[model samples]
Target: MEAVALHISNGVLNGPVSAIYGVIALVALAYCVSRGRRDLDDRLAPMAGLVAAFIFAVQMLNFPVLPGVSGHLLGGAMAALLVGPWVGALCVSVVLIVQALVFADGGVTALGANVANMALLGTAVAYLLIALLLRVLPRTPTGLGITAFVSSVFAVLAASQGFVLQYALGGTTDLEHYSLGAIAGLMAGTHLLIGIGEGLIAAVTVVTVARTRPDLVYALRGLKRPQPATAQGVAA
Candidate 1:
Protein backbone atom coordinates (compact mmCIF):
# COMPACT_ATOMS: atom_id res chain seq x y z
CA MET A 1 0.00 0.00 0.00
CA GLU A 2 1.10 3.60 -0.70
CA ALA A 3 1.80 5.98 2.16
CA VAL A 4 -0.80 8.68 2.61
CA ALA A 5 0.18 12.16 1.44
CA LEU A 6 0.99 14.85 3.99
CA HIS A 7 -0.80 17.75 2.22
CA ILE A 8 0.67 20.42 4.52
CA SER A 9 -0.60 18.59 7.57
CA ASN A 10 1.01 19.51 10.89
CA GLY A 11 0.46 16.13 12.56
CA VAL A 12 4.11 16.20 13.54
CA LEU A 13 3.78 19.35 15.67
CA ASN A 14 2.61 19.22 19.31
CA GLY A 15 0.27 21.36 21.38
CA PRO A 16 2.72 24.04 22.46
CA VAL A 17 4.06 24.46 18.95
CA SER A 18 0.58 24.70 17.55
CA ALA A 19 -0.40 27.29 20.14
CA ILE A 20 2.66 29.41 19.38
CA TYR A 21 1.92 29.30 15.69
CA GLY A 22 -1.73 30.13 16.34
CA VAL A 23 -0.81 33.25 18.26
CA ILE A 24 1.65 34.36 15.63
CA ALA A 25 -0.88 33.75 12.88
CA LEU A 26 -3.56 35.70 14.70
CA VAL A 27 -1.26 38.69 15.30
CA ALA A 28 0.06 38.70 11.75
CA LEU A 29 -3.40 38.36 10.25
CA ALA A 30 -4.65 41.18 12.44
CA TYR A 31 -1.87 43.40 11.20
CA CYS A 32 -2.69 42.48 7.64
CA VAL A 33 -6.34 43.34 8.21
CA SER A 34 -5.34 46.74 9.51
CA ARG A 35 -3.05 47.45 6.58
CA GLY A 36 -5.47 46.10 4.01
CA ARG A 37 -8.29 48.26 5.22
CA ARG A 38 -6.12 51.32 4.75
CA ASP A 39 -4.37 50.41 1.50
CA LEU A 40 -6.87 48.30 -0.44
CA ASP A 41 -9.02 50.21 -2.88
CA ASP A 42 -11.81 49.53 -5.35
CA ARG A 43 -9.23 49.00 -8.06
CA LEU A 44 -7.63 46.14 -6.19
CA ALA A 45 -10.76 44.54 -4.83
CA PRO A 46 -11.66 42.58 -7.95
CA MET A 47 -8.11 41.52 -8.58
CA ALA A 48 -7.81 40.36 -5.01
CA GLY A 49 -10.81 38.09 -5.35
CA LEU A 50 -9.56 36.71 -8.63
CA VAL A 51 -6.09 36.07 -7.28
CA ALA A 52 -7.45 34.32 -4.23
CA ALA A 53 -9.64 32.12 -6.35
CA PHE A 54 -6.80 31.32 -8.67
CA ILE A 55 -4.63 30.24 -5.78
CA PHE A 56 -7.37 28.09 -4.35
CA ALA A 57 -7.87 26.35 -7.65
CA VAL A 58 -4.16 25.94 -8.29
CA GLN A 59 -3.57 24.34 -4.90
CA MET A 60 -6.16 21.67 -5.54
CA LEU A 61 -4.16 19.91 -8.25
CA ASN A 62 -1.18 18.37 -6.49
CA PHE A 63 1.38 16.74 -8.76
CA PRO A 64 3.12 13.60 -7.62
CA VAL A 65 6.82 13.72 -6.84
CA LEU A 66 9.25 11.03 -5.60
CA PRO A 67 7.51 8.11 -3.93
CA GLY A 68 4.69 9.38 -1.73
CA VAL A 69 5.62 13.06 -1.78
CA SER A 70 3.62 15.49 -3.89
CA GLY A 71 4.03 19.14 -4.83
CA HIS A 72 1.72 22.04 -5.57
CA LEU A 73 1.94 25.75 -6.22
CA LEU A 74 1.92 27.83 -3.05
CA GLY A 75 0.92 30.90 -5.12
CA GLY A 76 2.25 33.14 -2.33
CA ALA A 77 4.92 34.90 -4.38
CA MET A 78 2.61 35.51 -7.31
CA ALA A 79 -0.09 36.91 -5.08
CA ALA A 80 2.33 39.23 -3.30
CA LEU A 81 3.74 40.51 -6.58
CA LEU A 82 0.30 41.14 -8.06
CA VAL A 83 -1.14 42.56 -4.87
CA GLY A 84 0.58 44.10 -1.84
CA PRO A 85 1.98 41.82 0.84
CA TRP A 86 -0.86 42.43 3.28
CA VAL A 87 -3.57 41.63 0.78
CA GLY A 88 -1.55 38.80 -0.63
CA ALA A 89 -1.27 37.25 2.80
CA LEU A 90 -4.97 37.66 3.23
CA CYS A 91 -5.58 35.91 -0.06
CA VAL A 92 -3.55 32.83 0.84
CA SER A 93 -4.96 32.84 4.36
CA VAL A 94 -8.46 32.79 2.95
CA VAL A 95 -7.60 29.82 0.76
CA LEU A 96 -6.05 27.95 3.68
CA ILE A 97 -9.03 28.68 5.89
CA VAL A 98 -11.48 27.21 3.43
CA GLN A 99 -9.31 24.21 2.80
CA ALA A 100 -8.96 23.50 6.50
CA LEU A 101 -12.51 24.19 7.61
CA VAL A 102 -14.59 23.08 4.67
CA PHE A 103 -12.52 20.46 2.90
CA ALA A 104 -10.49 19.17 5.86
CA ASP A 105 -7.43 19.26 3.71
CA GLY A 106 -5.10 20.23 6.55
CA GLY A 107 -5.31 19.68 10.28
CA VAL A 108 -7.68 21.94 12.19
CA THR A 109 -5.11 22.37 14.93
CA ALA A 110 -2.39 23.03 12.41
CA LEU A 111 -4.22 25.82 10.59
CA GLY A 112 -2.12 28.38 12.39
CA ALA A 113 1.16 26.87 11.32
CA ASN A 114 -0.11 26.44 7.81
CA VAL A 115 -1.07 30.09 7.61
CA ALA A 116 2.11 31.29 9.27
CA ASN A 117 4.31 29.34 6.93
CA MET A 118 2.53 29.59 3.56
CA ALA A 119 0.61 32.83 3.99
CA LEU A 120 2.88 34.95 6.15
CA LEU A 121 6.39 33.69 5.58
CA GLY A 122 5.86 32.95 1.92
CA THR A 123 4.31 36.31 1.11
CA ALA A 124 6.76 38.34 3.18
CA VAL A 125 9.79 36.66 1.66
CA ALA A 126 8.51 37.31 -1.85
CA TYR A 127 7.90 41.01 -1.19
CA LEU A 128 11.22 41.65 0.53
CA LEU A 129 13.37 39.69 -1.89
CA ILE A 130 11.75 41.13 -5.00
CA ALA A 131 11.91 44.65 -3.61
CA LEU A 132 15.62 44.23 -2.96
CA LEU A 133 16.17 42.71 -6.40
CA LEU A 134 14.32 45.53 -8.14
CA ARG A 135 16.99 47.92 -6.87
CA VAL A 136 19.72 46.24 -8.92
CA LEU A 137 17.67 45.05 -11.91
CA PRO A 138 16.14 47.33 -14.51
CA ARG A 139 12.54 48.59 -14.39
CA THR A 140 11.46 46.61 -17.45
CA PRO A 141 9.15 43.60 -17.82
CA THR A 142 12.15 41.29 -18.01
CA GLY A 143 13.50 42.72 -14.79
CA LEU A 144 10.21 42.25 -12.97
CA GLY A 145 9.94 38.69 -14.31
CA ILE A 146 13.43 37.90 -13.08
CA THR A 147 12.66 39.45 -9.74
CA ALA A 148 9.45 37.44 -9.38
CA PHE A 149 11.20 34.20 -10.35
CA VAL A 150 14.05 34.55 -7.88
CA SER A 151 11.83 35.79 -5.08
CA SER A 152 9.36 32.94 -5.60
CA VAL A 153 12.10 30.28 -5.50
CA PHE A 154 13.35 31.62 -2.18
CA ALA A 155 9.83 32.07 -0.82
CA VAL A 156 8.97 28.36 -1.19
CA LEU A 157 12.25 27.34 0.42
CA ALA A 158 11.61 29.67 3.34
CA ALA A 159 8.18 28.16 3.87
CA SER A 160 9.68 24.66 3.91
CA GLN A 161 12.20 25.83 6.51
CA GLY A 162 9.29 27.09 8.59
CA PHE A 163 7.95 23.54 8.73
CA VAL A 164 11.39 22.20 9.68
CA LEU A 165 11.57 24.70 12.52
CA GLN A 166 8.19 23.63 13.84
CA TYR A 167 9.21 20.00 13.61
CA ALA A 168 12.37 20.70 15.56
CA LEU A 169 10.35 22.46 18.25
CA GLY A 170 7.59 19.92 18.76
CA GLY A 171 7.47 17.26 16.12
CA THR A 172 5.60 14.09 17.07
CA THR A 173 7.87 11.93 14.98
CA ASP A 174 10.80 10.21 16.65
CA LEU A 175 13.96 12.27 16.34
CA GLU A 176 16.01 9.28 15.37
CA HIS A 177 13.66 8.24 12.59
CA TYR A 178 12.76 11.69 11.27
CA SER A 179 15.76 13.71 12.31
CA LEU A 180 15.65 17.47 11.97
CA GLY A 181 18.36 17.48 9.36
CA ALA A 182 16.66 14.77 7.35
CA ILE A 183 13.24 16.42 7.53
CA ALA A 184 14.67 19.77 6.50
CA GLY A 185 16.55 18.24 3.61
CA LEU A 186 13.55 16.35 2.33
CA MET A 187 11.17 19.29 2.60
CA ALA A 188 13.62 21.69 1.00
CA GLY A 189 14.58 19.28 -1.75
CA THR A 190 11.02 18.52 -2.80
CA HIS A 191 10.04 22.16 -2.61
CA LEU A 192 12.96 23.13 -4.78
CA LEU A 193 11.15 21.67 -7.79
CA ILE A 194 7.86 23.11 -6.68
CA GLY A 195 9.57 26.47 -6.27
CA ILE A 196 10.96 26.36 -9.78
CA GLY A 197 7.47 25.70 -11.14
CA GLU A 198 6.15 28.51 -8.94
CA GLY A 199 8.81 30.89 -10.26
CA LEU A 200 8.02 30.07 -13.87
CA ILE A 201 4.29 30.54 -13.39
CA ALA A 202 4.83 33.76 -11.48
CA ALA A 203 7.20 35.13 -14.11
CA VAL A 204 4.85 34.30 -16.96
CA THR A 205 1.85 35.80 -15.19
CA VAL A 206 3.76 38.98 -14.34
CA VAL A 207 5.04 39.31 -17.86
CA THR A 208 1.55 38.82 -19.28
CA VAL A 209 0.03 41.42 -17.01
CA ALA A 210 2.90 43.82 -17.61
CA ARG A 211 2.45 43.49 -21.35
CA THR A 212 -1.33 43.82 -21.39
CA ARG A 213 -2.43 45.55 -18.18
CA PRO A 214 0.57 46.79 -16.24
CA ASP A 215 -1.71 48.67 -13.88
CA LEU A 216 -2.91 45.39 -12.34
CA VAL A 217 0.55 44.23 -11.29
CA TYR A 218 1.38 45.91 -7.99
CA ALA A 219 5.10 45.18 -8.22
CA LEU A 220 5.27 47.14 -11.45
CA ARG A 221 3.19 50.00 -10.14
CA GLY A 222 5.83 52.72 -10.00
CA LEU A 223 7.82 51.50 -12.98
CA LYS A 224 6.96 52.66 -16.47
CA ARG A 225 5.27 50.12 -18.74
CA PRO A 226 7.15 48.68 -21.65
CA GLN A 227 6.31 50.02 -25.09
CA PRO A 228 5.47 47.80 -28.05
CA ALA A 229 8.26 46.88 -30.42
CA THR A 230 6.40 48.55 -33.29
CA ALA A 231 5.90 51.72 -31.24
CA GLN A 232 9.52 52.31 -30.30
CA GLY A 233 10.15 55.86 -28.96
CA VAL A 234 6.56 56.70 -29.88
CA ALA A 235 4.17 58.70 -27.75
CA ALA A 236 0.70 57.25 -27.12
Candidate 2:
Protein backbone atom coordinates (compact mmCIF):
# COMPACT_ATOMS: atom_id res chain seq x y z
CA MET A 1 0.00 0.00 0.00
CA GLU A 2 1.21 3.49 -0.82
CA ALA A 3 1.69 5.97 2.03
CA VAL A 4 -0.99 8.63 2.48
CA ALA A 5 0.10 12.06 3.56
CA LEU A 6 -2.13 13.89 6.03
CA HIS A 7 -2.93 16.52 3.41
CA ILE A 8 -6.29 16.07 1.78
CA SER A 9 -6.06 14.80 -1.78
CA ASN A 10 -8.19 15.64 -4.78
CA GLY A 11 -11.49 13.71 -5.21
CA VAL A 12 -11.71 13.28 -1.46
CA LEU A 13 -14.27 16.08 -1.30
CA ASN A 14 -17.00 17.05 -3.76
CA GLY A 15 -16.70 20.15 -5.95
CA PRO A 16 -19.20 22.32 -4.09
CA VAL A 17 -17.63 21.72 -0.70
CA SER A 18 -14.17 22.29 -2.08
CA ALA A 19 -15.26 25.52 -3.69
CA ILE A 20 -16.90 26.72 -0.51
CA TYR A 21 -13.77 26.13 1.50
CA GLY A 22 -11.72 27.83 -1.20
CA VAL A 23 -13.79 30.96 -0.85
CA ILE A 24 -13.54 30.85 2.92
CA ALA A 25 -9.79 30.45 2.72
CA LEU A 26 -9.41 33.35 0.32
CA VAL A 27 -11.48 35.69 2.47
CA ALA A 28 -9.71 34.67 5.66
CA LEU A 29 -6.30 35.09 4.10
CA ALA A 30 -7.30 38.47 2.71
CA TYR A 31 -8.17 39.50 6.23
CA CYS A 32 -4.89 38.16 7.45
CA VAL A 33 -2.99 40.07 4.83
CA SER A 34 -4.74 43.26 5.83
CA ARG A 35 -3.95 42.71 9.52
CA GLY A 36 -0.53 41.27 8.86
CA ARG A 37 0.48 44.51 7.21
CA ARG A 38 0.45 46.16 10.61
CA ASP A 39 2.19 43.24 12.33
CA LEU A 40 5.02 43.04 9.80
CA ASP A 41 7.63 45.64 10.61
CA ASP A 42 11.41 45.63 10.59
CA ARG A 43 11.95 42.74 12.98
CA LEU A 44 8.86 40.65 12.34
CA ALA A 45 9.06 40.93 8.56
CA PRO A 46 12.39 39.11 8.42
CA MET A 47 11.27 36.59 11.02
CA ALA A 48 8.11 35.87 9.01
CA GLY A 49 10.19 34.88 6.00
CA LEU A 50 12.32 32.60 8.10
CA VAL A 51 9.29 31.09 9.80
CA ALA A 52 7.63 30.27 6.47
CA ALA A 53 10.80 28.75 5.11
CA PHE A 54 11.36 26.68 8.22
CA ILE A 55 7.81 25.35 8.14
CA PHE A 56 8.10 24.50 4.45
CA ALA A 57 11.33 22.64 5.05
CA VAL A 58 10.20 20.75 8.12
CA GLN A 59 6.88 19.67 6.61
CA MET A 60 8.73 17.71 3.94
CA LEU A 61 10.09 15.22 6.48
CA ASN A 62 7.30 12.73 7.10
CA PHE A 63 7.00 10.16 9.88
CA PRO A 64 5.04 6.94 9.83
CA VAL A 65 1.77 7.06 11.71
CA LEU A 66 -0.38 3.99 10.91
CA PRO A 67 0.22 1.24 8.35
CA GLY A 68 0.19 3.48 5.30
CA VAL A 69 -0.51 6.89 6.78
CA SER A 70 2.25 9.45 7.34
CA GLY A 71 2.34 12.71 9.22
CA HIS A 72 4.57 15.76 9.35
CA LEU A 73 4.98 18.93 11.36
CA LEU A 74 2.03 21.27 10.95
CA GLY A 75 4.03 24.29 12.19
CA GLY A 76 0.94 26.31 13.03
CA ALA A 77 1.72 26.73 16.74
CA MET A 78 5.38 27.43 16.15
CA ALA A 79 4.64 30.10 13.57
CA ALA A 80 1.91 31.76 15.64
CA LEU A 81 4.14 31.87 18.73
CA LEU A 82 7.19 33.07 16.84
CA VAL A 83 5.28 35.66 14.85
CA GLY A 84 1.78 36.99 15.47
CA PRO A 85 -1.31 35.02 14.45
CA TRP A 86 -2.05 36.98 11.29
CA VAL A 87 1.43 36.64 9.89
CA GLY A 88 1.60 33.10 11.14
CA ALA A 89 -1.42 32.21 9.03
CA LEU A 90 0.22 33.73 6.03
CA CYS A 91 3.37 31.76 6.70
CA VAL A 92 1.56 28.47 6.85
CA SER A 93 -0.62 29.34 3.83
CA VAL A 94 2.43 30.10 1.75
CA VAL A 95 3.93 26.77 2.65
CA LEU A 96 0.78 24.86 1.77
CA ILE A 97 0.42 26.70 -1.54
CA VAL A 98 4.02 25.99 -2.49
CA GLN A 99 3.74 22.36 -1.55
CA ALA A 100 0.58 21.88 -3.53
CA LEU A 101 1.73 23.71 -6.63
CA VAL A 102 5.36 22.72 -6.79
CA PHE A 103 5.71 19.41 -5.02
CA ALA A 104 2.13 18.15 -5.59
CA ASP A 105 2.12 16.94 -2.00
CA GLY A 106 -1.49 17.96 -1.48
CA GLY A 107 -4.24 18.12 -4.06
CA VAL A 108 -4.37 21.37 -6.00
CA THR A 109 -8.14 21.48 -5.77
CA ALA A 110 -8.02 20.93 -2.01
CA LEU A 111 -5.68 23.87 -1.47
CA GLY A 112 -8.41 25.92 0.11
CA ALA A 113 -9.30 23.24 2.63
CA ASN A 114 -5.65 22.73 3.44
CA VAL A 115 -5.12 26.44 4.07
CA ALA A 116 -8.25 26.75 6.12
CA ASN A 117 -7.32 23.83 8.36
CA MET A 118 -3.56 24.18 8.88
CA ALA A 119 -3.14 27.91 8.40
CA LEU A 120 -6.28 29.48 9.80
CA LEU A 121 -7.79 26.97 12.21
CA GLY A 122 -4.52 25.57 13.53
CA THR A 123 -2.87 28.95 14.03
CA ALA A 124 -5.93 30.51 15.64
CA VAL A 125 -6.49 27.61 18.00
CA ALA A 126 -2.85 27.47 19.05
CA TYR A 127 -2.51 31.22 19.62
CA LEU A 128 -5.72 31.42 21.64
CA LEU A 129 -4.53 28.59 23.89
CA ILE A 130 -1.11 30.20 24.24
CA ALA A 131 -2.71 33.51 25.22
CA LEU A 132 -4.88 31.79 27.81
CA LEU A 133 -1.94 29.76 29.17
CA LEU A 134 0.33 32.79 29.45
CA ARG A 135 -2.24 34.58 31.58
CA VAL A 136 -1.75 31.98 34.34
CA LEU A 137 1.61 30.36 33.69
CA PRO A 138 4.80 32.18 34.66
CA ARG A 139 6.00 34.45 31.87
CA THR A 140 9.41 32.81 31.67
CA PRO A 141 11.21 30.70 29.10
CA THR A 142 10.11 27.58 30.88
CA GLY A 143 6.53 28.73 30.94
CA LEU A 144 6.51 29.61 27.27
CA GLY A 145 8.04 26.24 26.49
CA ILE A 146 5.27 24.50 28.37
CA THR A 147 2.71 26.63 26.62
CA ALA A 148 4.18 25.75 23.23
CA PHE A 149 4.06 22.05 24.01
CA VAL A 150 0.46 22.11 25.17
CA SER A 151 -0.78 24.42 22.44
CA SER A 152 0.91 22.52 19.64
CA VAL A 153 -0.64 19.27 20.77
CA PHE A 154 -4.12 20.73 20.76
CA ALA A 155 -3.51 22.61 17.51
CA VAL A 156 -2.62 19.44 15.61
CA LEU A 157 -5.66 17.65 17.01
CA ALA A 158 -7.89 20.53 16.04
CA ALA A 159 -6.48 20.63 12.50
CA SER A 160 -7.08 16.93 12.12
CA GLN A 161 -10.71 17.41 13.12
CA GLY A 162 -11.06 20.15 10.55
CA PHE A 163 -10.42 17.53 7.91
CA VAL A 164 -12.94 15.22 9.53
CA LEU A 165 -15.54 17.96 9.41
CA GLN A 166 -14.80 18.62 5.77
CA TYR A 167 -15.01 14.95 5.00
CA ALA A 168 -18.31 14.69 6.78
CA LEU A 169 -19.63 17.53 4.72
CA GLY A 170 -18.64 16.24 1.28
CA GLY A 171 -16.64 13.08 1.34
CA THR A 172 -16.58 11.16 -1.96
CA THR A 173 -15.00 8.03 -0.51
CA ASP A 174 -17.29 5.07 -0.02
CA LEU A 175 -18.05 4.11 3.57
CA GLU A 176 -18.73 0.42 3.22
CA HIS A 177 -16.29 -0.59 5.93
CA TYR A 178 -15.78 2.69 7.87
CA SER A 179 -18.25 5.11 9.40
CA LEU A 180 -17.66 8.80 10.02
CA GLY A 181 -17.11 8.15 13.72
CA ALA A 182 -14.51 5.54 12.94
CA ILE A 183 -12.72 7.89 10.60
CA ALA A 184 -12.73 10.67 13.16
CA GLY A 185 -11.44 8.37 15.86
CA LEU A 186 -8.63 7.10 13.71
CA MET A 187 -7.59 10.60 12.69
CA ALA A 188 -7.66 11.83 16.27
CA GLY A 189 -5.66 8.88 17.57
CA THR A 190 -3.00 9.02 14.88
CA HIS A 191 -2.73 12.80 15.16
CA LEU A 192 -2.32 12.55 18.93
CA LEU A 193 1.09 10.94 18.47
CA ILE A 194 1.98 13.41 15.76
CA GLY A 195 0.97 16.18 18.13
CA ILE A 196 3.35 14.95 20.82
CA GLY A 197 6.27 14.99 18.43
CA GLU A 198 5.27 18.44 17.16
CA GLY A 199 4.86 19.65 20.74
CA LEU A 200 8.40 18.70 21.74
CA ILE A 201 9.86 20.43 18.71
CA ALA A 202 7.74 23.52 19.27
CA ALA A 203 8.62 23.63 22.99
CA VAL A 204 12.36 23.48 22.43
CA THR A 205 12.24 26.03 19.65
CA VAL A 206 10.10 28.51 21.58
CA VAL A 207 12.19 28.14 24.74
CA THR A 208 15.44 28.71 22.89
CA VAL A 209 14.14 31.86 21.23
CA ALA A 210 12.49 33.14 24.40
CA ARG A 211 15.71 32.71 26.35
CA THR A 212 17.83 34.51 23.81
CA ARG A 213 15.38 37.22 22.71
CA PRO A 214 11.99 37.20 24.30
CA ASP A 215 11.10 40.38 22.43
CA LEU A 216 10.95 38.50 19.16
CA VAL A 217 8.50 36.03 20.63
CA TYR A 218 5.05 37.47 19.87
CA ALA A 219 3.39 35.43 22.62
CA LEU A 220 5.82 36.81 25.23
CA ARG A 221 5.40 40.46 24.29
CA GLY A 222 2.23 41.10 26.27
CA LEU A 223 3.25 38.95 29.22
CA LYS A 224 4.66 41.07 32.06
CA ARG A 225 6.13 39.40 35.11
CA PRO A 226 5.70 41.32 38.33
CA GLN A 227 8.91 42.81 39.63
CA PRO A 228 10.33 41.28 42.80
CA ALA A 229 10.33 43.39 45.97
CA THR A 230 13.67 45.19 46.37
CA ALA A 231 15.94 44.96 49.47
CA GLN A 232 15.46 48.72 50.06
CA GLY A 233 11.67 48.34 50.15
CA VAL A 234 11.95 45.43 52.54
CA ALA A 235 14.28 47.43 54.82
CA ALA A 236 11.87 50.35 54.84
Index of the highest-TM-score prediction = 2
Instruction: Please name the candidate that would achieve the greatest lDDT relative to the true structure.
Output: 2
Candidate 1 displacement at residue 128 in angstroms = 0.9
Q: Candidates' lDDT values, in order?
A: 0.82, 0.87
Per-residue alpha-carbon lDDT of model 2 for 74-123, expressed as tens digits? 99999988998899999999999988987777898999999999999999
Show model 2 residue runs off by greater than 4 Å.
1-6, 65-69, 223-236
For model 2, how big is the CA root-mean-square deviation? 4.3
* TM-scores for all predictions: 0.88, 0.91
How far residue 116's Cα lies from its native spot in candidate 1, in Å, is 0.6
What C-alpha lDDT, on a 0 to 100 scale, does residue 231 get in candidate 2?
18
- List ranges where model 1 is wrong by over 4 Å: 1-6, 64-68, 222-236
